[model samples]
Target: MAQLAAARQGTHSTKTRAEVSGGGRKPYKQKGTGRARQGSIRAPQFTGGGVVHGPKPRDYSQRTPKKMKAGALRGALSDRAREGRIHVVSELVTGDVPSTKKAMAVISALSLEGKVLLVVGREETTSWLSLRNVPNTHVLSPDQLNTYDVLVSDQVLFTKAALETFTAGAPTGKSVKAVAAESEVEA
Candidate 1:
């Protein structure tokens, strides 16, 4: 919920009478001939007046407890896993450079449809570039994973390294470095 709220761009704004331009002087005298009281043209009653009770820019971020956030993520992943929507792949390779053909082949092999979330332990440029163009496919690092993305995706594909990172508990610098070292040895 916090992630979803933060995603919203609350940039809406409105100009008040003081902020509106070209309303420095009064339009007419206070006592008018068969006319209502007069004020600045920027008054709300005027046609070119400033907005009233208008929206303003604000931050929609919510402060969720760390435990609650962790629990929610675990629950989401558990639900998906129970539903058999989580697939753990041995590895996601696309040669030394990114290749759309290789990425497409992998997607086809997995038979992934709709929204697919591919989680990786590290930021591999080749993998990211290769899968970026695939429709309905999103490649994200394990640390970037959240309950919203997990729940929204039709299928969640976790690379072996990513699975290990999750199973090892919260991601830390030491753990990430260890994972990288392991991948290097394997490669």
Candidate 2:
């Protein structure tokens, strides 16, 4: 939940009476007026008045411990793997630019449905762009992988290079060499 909460964009804002303009003069006399007292036209009671106790812009981000975050990510991935939803593709070859047709062919070949999270290695722009136009598909580098995305995705597809990078030094008990060798065989 922390990760999901932090992902929210807290851009809401509301102006207070002090922040509202054109309220310098008193709306009415203090004693003569039978109406309720109001210091400025920008008071909450006025039609165009500033909001009272309304939302304010703030940062929703929260800091999670590095170990905790890693643990959560590992747990999520482990669950997906246990459920047989994780796929390791030998490669994600794409042309110089985005190609929705190629992406569709890959998806169909893998029989992936629902939301698919594609993990790629650094500087894999062609592969990333290729999957951009594919609906329900999202591309991210190994560094950008998070527990939320892993859990939410119905299928997690990792390129050979990305799988190696993602599993490097991870506590999954699978050595980088083993993963690389497997990917090599697949290639």
1-187: candidate 1 lDDT, tens digit per residue: 7988988899999988778888888777777467887678898888878899899899988997766777787777777767777887776774687887876787779897889999876756677778877889888987788888888999888887777775666544433221222222121
User: Which ranges of candidate 1 are over 4 A from the true structure?
Assistant: 171-187
lDDT scores in order: 0.75, 0.77
Name the runs in model 2 displaced over 4 angstroms: 32-38, 94-103, 169-187
Report backbone clashes per prediction: 0, 0
In the predicted model 2, the residue pairs found to clash are none
Residue 51's lDDT in candidate 1: 91
- In candidate 1, how many Å is residue 32 off? 5.6
Q: What lDDT tens digits, residue by residue, belong to model 2 across residues 1-187?
A: 8877887899999899888878889878898778888888888889878899999989888887776777777677767776778888766765577676776787789898899999988777778777777779889988788888988899989887888786664546542311222322232
Structural similarity to truth (TM-score) of each candidate:
0.82, 0.75
User: lDDT at 26 for candidate 2?
Assistant: 87
